[model samples]
Target: MIQLPYPRLNVIFEALRYEALPQQELAQRCDISTRTIRTDISALNDILASYGAQIQHQRGKGYHFDIYDETRFLDIEKQTKKMKSSPRNAKDRMVYLMMRLLSQEEECKLDDLANQWFVSRTSLQADMGEIREQLEQYNLELISKAHCGLRLFGEEQAIRACIAHILFQFKPSDHTFIDVCEYFFPEINQPSLKTDLLELINKNHIKLTDEGLHHLVVYCGVALHRLKQNACIHHVDQPNLSEEAQKTAAELSQTIESLLGAPLPQAEIDYLSIQIAARRVTGVPEIDTQKPTEQLELTQYLLDYVNTHYNYDLRNDEQLKRDLLCHITTMILRVKYQITIPNPLFDHIKRYYPLAYDMTVAAISHWGKHLIPDGEIGYLVMHIGVGLERNFSLEEQLPPKALLVCDSGTSIVRLLESQLIRSLPQLTIEKVESLRDYEELSKVDADFVISTEKVSQKNKPTITVSPIPTSFQLEQVNKLILMNRSHPYMLDKFFDHRYFSVLDEPMTQGEVLKKFSAHFTEDNITPIEFYDSVIERESITSTILGEGIAIPHSLGLLANETKVYTIISPHGVDWGNGKIAHVIFLFAINKDDYEEAMSLYDLFVTFMNGKAVDTILGCHSYDEFQYVAKECWFNRKKDW
Candidate 1:
């Protein structure tokens, strides 16, 4: 039998067992990237082919398993279960060892552990080295007693964090803490605990995601179990709580005590307060009038930084101020206690709100004293990004203009122009006339021309459509209009010969960034602050845009003019996010050149989204790069 290598194969198969799963859904359910999931489906189909079955991926519908031979497919599923009985690889061994250490109270003998994996003691010892390194990251230790063998030793909260990490890594997204604990340690599992917890939260008016609720259950379960074993937590820093929050925490502590048949110490109660404070709990308890001076100072610093740098005034935005205060208050507690919360929207926030992310990075660097993590920075991005977006929306935006050209008469042209105006409310119709009149015009004043006749204009976007447009044609027109409305700036204008480099030598992302930064500074194209900003932005999230391309740029314009520095690595540079890029586009823009910067960026995205990425990377010289850019972009289907 060809056993599946993936431990999460069942997660995919079970999802596709009933209905088709969209690529996004599969990605979320598996907690893996969609790119990885797409690749896995292809691999899965190869395996299923032997069983006379295949996984069909329809763009709109998603992946569905089509099994020709039910018995063979069933056999494959059964084989997956048998493979699960024994750890197959290092990753599996690590997870299994962690589970063993966490679920059991007593020390694990090397002999028993070796027997469990059918490995010699020497082999198990080697594996334990890696396990020790992994545990250290969570501030947990693998301790060996003279007579008792090995056991995990850490603060109760840290150990629980390890358990939560393992649970999240191996299971489907929907599995609750109860589900995981029941599977691994049925003796301590409480099925009704989730329901009781929900009731208590509802009664206290505490708001948390289902995932957060599950997390609380695991924390409570582990604390209860450890308390029973007399392994209670100690010296936990007391979290600052509002009067309302304090009341809720007190009620929650009382409820947990009654449910677990265990008594809690003051330190344990405080730890629970920390958990509540760190999470997105609703109905915050009342607090003292005065705020923490340090947090208030930090908030004022953030508001001032935005006003000074970005020219946005948020000093009087009470809601924004209050949100920042709450976040910083909880953040201080988290930093002290080593608590972590995952931001699911981190990537989206970074991608869409580049400016806000930049501002947040600067503020954190200046105020944080080098202590905050990337995850926490993400939360700040949302707040600042939203504030900036709101301010931007208040400003007037110029609508896209379209010059309609038709070979038909005025009567037909008039009707067509009216229809186009009705269909595309966002577009400004500059003129509706014959192609002859358009040619007679010395210059095209509009962004893009919509015509029944084909016009060759390398500079502007053109859409060849029916005089009376169809739905498909309208979609094409809409895409072009939006593209034209976005900055039509090109990177070639800013592409300096001295700034560009073709590196045949193997280089890492950091090395590439360092080389590019030095060139920019030496040439006086930008100051060191620009390069520092670029590196800082990268530290928050990677600049990889997929398809073997990365565009690493700083947050704010740090140059006199927008400039792009190109680096071609025949051997791909790892750009984090499990992506390797052969072409690295590192650039910096001036604050005044933001529009041009956005245009160049949109064009780059267009190139990545099309078949041009491969061709661009294949270019041997700067001339070839320009040639490919013009040919690929202008010649691209006028649909966008």
Candidate 2:
């Protein structure tokens, strides 16, 4: 396996994720000089060639990765992933240095560190300054000794938390050790530490996030090293721990003591309990698990808000409630200690799970205020989002069924039903009867009604086909089956020509939002309160999804009726957070029309995921916008 410097490897990996990028664009995104990027690419290719992968350069399109043998390429990826080595970039290096400092029991001299990294002492000092700033976030500081080196000094709890937070940020392979001490100093690595930790977790039936589990294991290893040097955690006002967590912590301490062949102190046990309590798993809360009055009240408030606005029956979801309570409990401790956990998946979460992300933003605004940042909100989104996904999955698996109506004999009807079943594995034949049997029936009770004769049952969808359906008939049936599986009707009514507008000039997000919303207010299409809610929602988090599309919608139903307003800017406008959005969707829905709002949102997401955005960007007229949307919706692939 080959290793590139910290950020250089990271930058190359990022560049490989895209199709192609211009040299200037690549350099700007990586925050490096073009010459440095070129040199790095050359060096990276030399390493990649060994794994049957090469970074290819186009004349003017920048660099892209070409893999000649996927198996070999993946092998290298796996090896590199297991190593989890530090990137050579400045930010990663600072994090690496901090991890090294946190894991050490003694001061590390500046010259020694510089010599180890083959860097000048002055350069190392600059990195230390950055590390100092990061430590200050946790209320920790770097103390320099006259004849000695620098050492980190702070509250014992804060130092432990800093170590946990730093280790948690890096994702290690399943079989690999997540211990920083192991990464920096292999001789100090305890191979049995992870094995013993897992055994303790399993014996006590402890469950935690993968990252949480890794952090706890690494923290325990470092704590053991420090405690051996007589650096024990002092007493502090501790947060309450659950009975189950207390037991788990005791078992963990016993396991560690056994592994090290030493008797653990009471202070170590208490510290372990504190760490365990801070990351209690997401499960049914124990009967005696205590919750702070204010946080519990806020949890109820948020649940009610979600229920009232989205009409989701989440109140009965014990897992969601328990998860939220545990998360908030941990959050309070993090806030009090000024401990920040950086979420590496923030961008991906914001982009892929906008609705969940939006709901999280609302919750943060209502409860967190200065306490929660975007990173924490992202984790909250994952918890709530999983519940919502489960709900949708249940809806999709209700079974696709079809009603068969033919003026033929019973044998022919059975043959048609069998052929239909054979063609569509997911489809179930609900009814097989003659035309007379069909006419006597009051209604159709299936996903789609397949009749030889043309029968229209108002809102019910019916397809006409021969007794022995042709290939084209099967295609139509397939399309109808897909249509039936889509969300509740009212998609077409959501978007209207009356609400669509083409801007004469590019405007800021605020200007576009205000201008489009005022039209609704003036026409009595929406209430005055609606405008305020939309703007407030935008302020909570920018709705920009990049690639020139922004969806701004209020959480509550303040509009007089459900409506979607499309405002297009030929030149993209700044939608905050360095995003320039050309397409803006102003969605206003009534309280009872939540279903329609969600359906419209799904369509918009699909549209943005396809080539429709390109067509939309090329459009000069409102008619073109509508046409592009129509084409995209019909051709869009089902991702959800």
Give the per-residue lDDT of model 2 (tens digit) for 236-312. Answer: 56567677677888888887777556888777787787776666564445423364465576566667777766677
Q: Can you give the TM-score per candidate against the true fold? A: 0.75, 0.63
Best by TM-score: 1
Clashing pairs in 2: 5-88, 6-87, 6-88, 7-88, 7-89
Candidate 1 residue 546 Cα shift, in angstroms, is 4.7
Clashing pairs in 1: 207-282, 243-286, 244-285, 244-286, 245-285, 557-589
Candidate 2 minimal-lDDT segment of 10 residues? 173-182
Q: What is the C-alpha lDDT of each candidate?
A: 0.71, 0.71
lDDT (Cα) of model 2: 0.71
Candidate 2, position 517, lDDT: 88
Residue-level lDDT of model 1, residues 1-640, one tens digit each, is: 2345575665686689789989878875665557778788887777779887888988889889787898886786676455555555555666777778876778998888788766678867787877887689778888798878898877777886677666644323433323445546565544566777677777776778776776666667766766766776777756556554566667778866885687778788877777766665443233333765666777778989877765668877766777777677767666666666666667656555556776787777777553776677888878876776555554455998888888888887888888888998888888776767777777677877888888866446678888789999998887666545444336445776666678888998888898888788787878878777788878766777555667888765678667899888888898885678877889877777664455565566666655465577678788788767755565454554
